[model samples]
Each structure stands twice: as C-alpha cells, then as structure tokens.
Target: MGTGWLPWSAASLASGAVLLVLAALTLPPTSEVGQVVGTVRREDAAWLMASAAFFLASVALTMGLPAILTLIPAKQQVVGLVGVWIWSIGTIGTSALAAFLILFRATVRVIDISPTDVEQLGQDPVMTLSLLFVFGAFYLGELVVALVLLLASRLPRWIPALLLVHIAAAPVNHLLPEQLQGVQAVVLGGGLMALAVRSTEAWAALRAPATR
Candidate 1:
C-alpha cells in the first residue's frame, strides 16, 4: 500500500496538537469562573471569544485523530474506523454543546438575565444531556481508539503505550491544581507530535527503494 497518506495524517495530527495547546492556554481557569463571567459581562469579549475558539480547536483535534487512523492496515481498518466513528460523534456532540454554552452565556450577559435564570440555565436539561454525551461518549471513544491501537500493532509499542498512559492519568489530572491542569494539554500535544515524527520516519522508510 502507498504510504502517501502518512504525511498528511502526520501533519493533521501535529496541527491538532498545536490547536490543543492553544485551547489550553486560552481557556479560563475553572477556579476563576466567577471572575471570568464578570469580565465577560463587563463587555470584555476576550474570554468568551477565547473559550469559543478553544472549544472549536478541540473539534479540530478530534477530527484529526480519525484522519490519522486511516493509515492503519486493511485487516485492522475496521477497528480503526469504528473507533473513529465513535470519537467523531462524541467530538461533534461536545463541540456543539460547548458552542451553545458560550452563546448562551453571551446572551445572558447581553440581556442582563437574573441570577436565578442563569442558575436555571446552568441546570438546564439540555446542558445536562450535553455534558453526559460529551464526557461519556468522549471517554468511551478514546478507550476504543487506545484499545484498537494496542491490539493492531500498527505503530510502535511506545506510541500506543503513551496514549494508554495518558488516558489512565485522567483522574489524576483532575486532582492537579488549576494552574497545573493545562499541563496535561501540553503533555498530550507532545505525545501527538512524537507520533507525528514517528509516522513521518516510517512513511519515508516505506517509500525508500529496496536495497540490493
């Protein structure tokens, strides 16, 4: 099979990493949620725009994963495709929910909605459903991808190992200090970049003419 897809896949994966890093850096800290809301209410669009951009970047990152999986061997392609479909659904759901939240917040700010109303919106059924789909589907999707990669043996052992480790560390990541939480994004980005580099090298080798 031609290796031409590898470079494009690597580039998409690398770009996803970059976008994830940007999302992390731009995202407002949960600890400062009140302050962020206040700032957004005061006609400061920075945080709101940043949040929107970050969520959108996450969508892009999610999309890139499936694209890269296309490089998997034919026999294992079914597994990769299944994982990709699951993840893509979660990605789309999460991104849409996030985008909706951002818009709702902006609307509240502009309309000067009451605290009670805002609180109700926080507990809105749609919001709950969105959160459920986002976290539940997203995590499950990630697990599927990780498991498929581990089983397929398409890439180096270390690549899938790193992915599994990253997934396993999710609980511990939440325990990290607010300021330190973003570090996970950096770590993830580094892992993806490493995968990209490895893919590039392997693709080149595959394309090289056979030695006598």
Candidate 2:
C-alpha cells in the first residue's frame, strides 16, 4: 500500500482503539447491570451521549478508509476479526483488532443492567426506547462488519465458522430484550477481540516467514 493509505488506516484504527476504551469507561457499572438504581439519570445520559458522539466520529473515520488507502484499490477487503490472516498482517490486521474491541464492548455493556431494572426502564418511555434503539443498533453495526468479514471469499480460513454464527446473531438480538442483549454483546465482542489478537500475530509471522 502507499504511504497515505498506511497512515490513514493506522490513524483510524488508533482512534477506534481509544473509542473502545472510552466506550468501556462510559459503560454502566457492574452493580447497576440490571438494576434501575443509580446516583442520577443525568450522568448516564451524558455518558451515553458522549459515547454516541465518539461512535459518530468513528463512523466517519471508517468511511475515509477506502479513499485514503488508494494504494490498495481493493473494494470490500476482508474486515474480519480473525479472517484478516488471509492478508499479511499490517494495518489491515490492526483494523481487524480494533474492530473486535469495539464490538466486544457493545455486546457486554448490557449485562450490567438487571432484569428488574429493565422492567423499570420500560416504564420510562424515553429511556426504554433510547436504550433499545441505541444499544441494539450500535451492536448491530458490529455484527454487520463481522458478517462482512466472514462471508468475503477474500478472507482467510483461520477465522472459524463460529465467527459467522455469532455475527449473524446481531439482528436476532433485536428480537429479544436488553437482559439477553447484553449477553449477546459480550459474546460477539469477545469473539472479535480474540480474532484480532491472534490474527495480527499470525500475520506478523507470515510477513517475516524467513525467520520461521
């Protein structure tokens, strides 16, 4: 790839990495996992809004990749968590890593909300709708990418079939409520991160195959 494509992907992935960490920080505490109990709703809104803001920014960054990486004129390159091994590990590999971290958090964030709290959330129309729309939608994007990665014939075989299974679950997740949603989020998120770590390393080995 050209110098420009390399930097853009790296920067976008870096920003994405920070967003994931910040997203984690914005997550509701374990104590409030399923409970409506909290110091104040105002604080929660602020955090969610902040995360949303970063999420929007992340989206923009992601969009810029295709153009910036003009060096590689490939369209629909594998964006897999594990499937990136098909391409030598590099910025492409890191993109897979960042993708996983982002998705991982989306899935697990809901476990912190309790069943009773979810019911209470239902009574509060604004929070209920917002909760359903925001979290569910956000997690859906994660699954979308995972699906994109898994199905692309360009993707490596290292990615297990399970990756596709979990990714396909995103839309189905919407059929259920928040309590179950959170569990689904964690499962998908964990899968993404795992794929990132291992794929990147394998890519590295391939790049320097002579060393091995």
Candidate 3:
C-alpha cells in the first residue's frame, strides 16, 4: 500500500476519535459531580458553541465514511455503499441523543420535578422515536451489510462482530434512565473505537510478508 493510505487512514481514525468524543459528550448526561446533565440553553453562548462543535464533528464524521471508501482501492469497496449507510446511522443515533436532551430540559423546566415529568423523562416519546430511527437503521443495516460483506468476502471478521455488539447494546441502553446512560455511552464509545481500528488491523495483517 502507498504511504497515502497511511495519511488517509490516520485522518479517518483522527476524525473518528473527535467524533467519539462528541458522541460520548452529547450521548449521556454529565453530572456536575454525580450525574447532572449540563443545560443546553442558548442563554449561555458557550453552551451553544460547544453544542455546535459536537453536532458538526459528529455529523461530519458520520458523513465522512463515504468519502473514505472512495479513497480506498476499488477491490475493497464492494459493500462500501452499504457501509456509508451504516455509518450515517451514527449521525442518526447522535442526533437522537441530542433530542433526548430535551427530556432533561423538560425535567428542569417545571416548577417542581413532578412525578409526571419524572415518568415522562424515563420514557420520552420524541427521543424514543429518534432512538428507533438510528438504532433500528443501524441494527438491521449492520446485519445486512455484514452479511453482504461477508458473502462478498470484503470485510474483516471483527468488523461485523463489533458492529453487531454495538447494535444490540443500543436498545437496552436507551431503556436506562438518563443518569444510567453513561454506562451505555461508554459501551458505545468502545464499540466505535473497535470499528474504527479494524481497518488498521486488516492492513497490518496483510502487510506481513508471509501472507503476501
């Protein structure tokens, strides 16, 4: 492989890292000490700025996968379109997460943390739909894409397993309370890292002279 693949993969990995941070930041509620989610009020210009950065980087990272496939050799791109759709699911998932923040906002909105609001927070209709949009697409799409890639002999073994694990974990995590979401966030973060690094592993394996 050319040195250009090095920079290409590096850029992809670097972008994935930044996007992972955004995913974690915006995914779970961050406590002041224990488990307090930060407010998303536009009153604080700083929060707005941070939110912008998080969404942009996350979306860019989601959208960037298509471009990345283009950079790779045609031989490696058999299931790449499906891969792009699969990656776009990240944007959907994180967007759902941002929308889920609205439930927390509603909690903070009331004069009292009413039982209704508390219950509602546990089961937000809007965020539920959002989660369905992303998690569903990603979940089903990953399986299909993985199967296709596998049949086509275009994907590494770890890629499908890693994605399947993440896809399966998503629904269970969404059922958790906002505070309990951090655990899910951590799981998702690790999953993303696993998917991101698979390419590097494949490259390394191929580079060994005995294989060649």
Best by TM-score: 1
Q: Per-candidate RMSD vs. true structure?
A: 3.5, 10.7, 6.9
Provide the TM-score for each candidate, comma-separated: 0.76, 0.39, 0.54
Cα lDDT tens digits for candidate 3, 84-180: 6775675557555554444455545554454454555558787567667775665565565455445554455655555566667665765666666
Which regions of candidate 2 fall more than 4 Å away from where they truly are?
Answer: 1-6, 25-28, 31-122, 157-212
lDDT of 1 by residue, 1-212 (tens): 66566687677768867876776666665653234355456544545655665566566666466554644667878877887777667666656755775886668667866656656666789877868777677667767776777777777777666666766777887677888887767776776777677667766776676643
Q: Candidate 3 — which pairs collide?
A: 31-36
Residue 163, model 1: lDDT of 63
Give every collision pair in model 1: none
Candidate 2 contains a number of clashing pairs equal to 11
- Compared with the true structure, all predictions reach lDDT values of 0.67, 0.43, 0.52
